[model samples]
Target: MNQYPLWKNLLILGVVLFGILFALPNVFSQDPSIEVSAARGHEVTEATPDEVRAVLQNVGVPFKAVEPLAEDKVLVRFPSSGDQLRGQEAIEAHLADRYNSALTLVADLPGWLRAIDAQPMYLGLDLRGGIQVLIDVDMEAALEQGLERYTGDIRSLLRQEKIRYLTVMNDANRVTVKFGDAETLDKGRKLIDREFRELEFETASDGKNFDLYARLAPAEEEQLRDFALQQNITTLRNRVNALGVAEPIVQRQGERRIVVQLPGAQDPARLKEILGATATLEFRLVDTEGSVQDAVEGRVPVSSRLYYDREGRPVLLKRSVIVTGDQITNATSGFDQNSGTPAVFVNLDSRGARRMREVTTENVGKPMAVVFIENRTVTEMVDGEPVKRQVRTEEVISVANIREPFGRRFQTSGLDSSEEAHNLALFLRAGALAAPIQIVEERTIGPSLGQENIDQGVKSVVYGLAAVLIFMGLYYRIFGLVADLVLLTNLVLIVAILSLLQATLTLPGIAGIVLTMGMAVDANVLIFERIREELRNGSSPQASINAGYGKALSTIVDANITTLIAAVILFSFGTGPVKGFAVTLSVGIFTSMFTAILGSRAVVNLIYGGRRLSKLAI
Candidate 1:
């Protein structure tokens, strides 16, 4: 009755072996290294290794090896974290302003193992060194910008339809188009109702002016805000990916706030530079009929504006924008056909492509300009005091004549270098932020502190496991040894599942593991006690063993199911560390039940199932 079928035995053995294979990678740990990725144009080629070696040699910084990675990246491995830091600084100093370098911990597993794509579970910011930033998005500014765009759209619509309008103005939250007569206002309202379904238009007569007011409905406003937040999150994720940060976290914290955690991020300032800046591109016609000198001398035309280029030369541009950066679906950096100089190739979305075709068809051979706009924040010391300031810069990056009525794909030249072209392409491809974000809080965790936390967490788990093993072994005798083996197997299965899933492990996750260790043997304890009761009742040894597991199964299932429900709830409603704890706890509960009930039974049956005895070991 205690014998397990051959298939059952094989299944258990297979699971154990599978767990061992996945869990073995963790034993190799990670090595201190510096990850080098191109900031913009330069690719990481085979020559990069030699350059890195030369730099290290020049600076007297020792390194183990420099290896090229995928996606134009490279890794410089060092003997220790100290050497990693020193070598990174040396390389940065030598390269000057060429690449973006960050200190990272990479797995030192054998190449054969990596060939199969086996990797260790990622560690979170709390467990590894990184930067955590809290950003608050400006929703009011977003709304105002949306209203301004609406006003511009209404102005263009009226002009296109040849409808007479006195003025179109955007105030705090609404756009008002005033007509000279009520008839014109009615025509404008009908046109808006047919074209713009997202806006609610109302007409009114204020004695002399017949005005049509347009505003977003309450539901539309709410949707716009949500869309802005989500769009910013997506944009930030793209920017972080371009930075080549491994396992970065960019998630919405609340309605208007976002939380960003970059694992193994060494330079917070550089991160802020990328995350905080709002970069976008706009195309408009160059106003050749207007005088730039007159505009610069404060005689600006109403339909045109004056802007400076990268070299501080003023130019006149039409006030209307042809297309914005958000309309760009793709961008790539390559050499121009005729000049062979570096340039950016851009592809527009369907609507943008149509608009481009229309505009170019109307104004062929006229000069057009691509304007690059960036808003950034600078912090500096002023009169021995820390001060923060916001700065906005707009410059024309490219100017070319529209050769024909082409759309969908176009190229922009006149960039300073290939690096600038690459950087611009990356920015355009990432899309523009719907709203600006301000960094309200920033925190950095040093690698040494992270290592200390890891050590303490490991010690806690080891001590807890040792205590549990000793208690179970002493209390249950031979049967207890079987339980101890199952407990170890449970730990392995939990780790293997975690590694296979590639879940991030945090410090709180360690606590969950320690708790799991204590809880793993509960089912075994119940089974052992039930068997003892059966023995006291004078049942046969085999019968008692069979009855113990049968009677204890329900209790084990009931206890674990209830706790699993709690873990699921925690995972659903929790954030960050709490969620991390819940994940491990949930996984542990399942693994423990399998190992304690089924695995232990398989082992016991193989050992004591074949024959009867006068006395049992237990």
Candidate 2:
């Protein structure tokens, strides 16, 4: 009556084995290593390992292994962190122009385990040493840029329609266009009202000149702000992915700020470079009529601007942009078919493709320049004082003749090397941020401190488990041992599920596990005490055991269900560490219920189910 069926026993055994297989990966430790990747056009071939070995040999640094990785990367493992750092520096210095090296900790799991893609659970930034940054988006600047674009579009529209205007000016919040007479002003106002539904136009006149002012509607402004924030978040996420950071966090904080946490990121400076710089692309017509020498001498043309190339050669380009980086949907680096030179293939969105077609069709045989613009901050000495200055650099990366009208896809050549092409493609793929962001706060957690946290957390779990195990083994004797075994299994199951789900673990999560250990025994205690009560009422051993579990099932379910509800609520509403705690608690509740009721009962039935006993152990 108390024994489980053969199928149920097999099913329980299968689950236990499944949990063990997934939980086994955590036993393997990570190794200190240096990851070597091609900077741009370079490739890490089989010979790359030999080259790295030579470099490390020359530097007198010993390495455990030099292995080739996918995607033109290499991994150089060392026995210690000191050797890892030394080897990384030596490699970087020797191949500064060709390769980029970063120190990292890679999992040293067996090939067979990795074949199934088994991995340990990801740890949060607090548990894994890494960098944390808080970036503040410049919403005011974004609004201003949007208004400026609208002002330019309005001017172009009026000119295209042959509507004459005396002057056009854009202030912080409004664009004003002055016409010579009321008739022209009325015609312009009607045209704007018909074409631009997002703008609200106001008309004023002082008898001589008529003026029409256009301002973005309130709803439109809010939408623009929201779009800007969302776009910046997406751009940052893309950049982080390109960096190949594992388990990075790029999330919005409040309305205009973003919090980025990069766990296991080795080089914080490189991360800052990737996150801080705003790189963008613009296609503009090369102004053949304007002399670069004239513009360089400060006599720039009204309709053209001068920019330098990567080699410091100046070229004149038109002020009007044909298309911006935002229109690019995809980009990749490859070789030109005929010349075999490094080139970037770009694919634009539908709107951008149409615009490109129109522009190229009108200006066939003319040269168009692909301009690379970067906005960065640097510290410069001014009057013997170090001052932070914002610098803007614009360079023409490619200038090619428009042989035929094309859209959607095109190739840009003239890149100096494959590395340049690769870097350009990476930048284009990441896209440009909609608004500028400044890092307002920064923090770095050292690995030693992170290790300390892990040590303490592990100690807490060990101590808590030991205390509970001893208490259970002494209090109820044999049945208590059964509960302890189930409790241990419950912990293993929780970890296996976490690893399978790839949930990040934090300190509070460890606390949740400890709390779960205590609660896991509660259900067993309820059942045991119920059995004792039945035995006191003169029931037989097997009958008392059956009565105990049957009577206690409803109460255990009710108690656990209520706690599970609270855990779910916490996970839904809480953020960061709180959510981590809630997740562990919620997962623990389910596993504990399974092990306590079904697992404990299965073992008990095996031990005492069919045997006729005069008295119980309790």
Instruction: State the lDDT of candidate 1 residue by residue for 97-214, as single tens digits.
Output: 4565666777889988788777787677877777777888889877876776677788878889999998887755898888999888888999988888989988889779798899
In candidate 1, position 116 carries an lDDT of: 74
lDDT of each: 0.82, 0.83
lDDT by residue (20-43, candidate 2, tens digit) is 889888888877777787643466
Best by TM-score: 2
Task: Evaluate model 2: give its lDDT.
Answer: 0.83
In Å, residue 321's CA in model 1 sits off its true spot by: 3.5
Q: Over all chains combined, what TM-score does candidate 1 have? A: 0.75
lDDT of 2 at 74: 85
Give me the runs in candidate 2 sitting further than 4 Å from their true place: 41-63, 80-98, 134-144, 166-230, 238-247, 251-258, 264-279, 283-298, 307-316, 326-431, 437-445
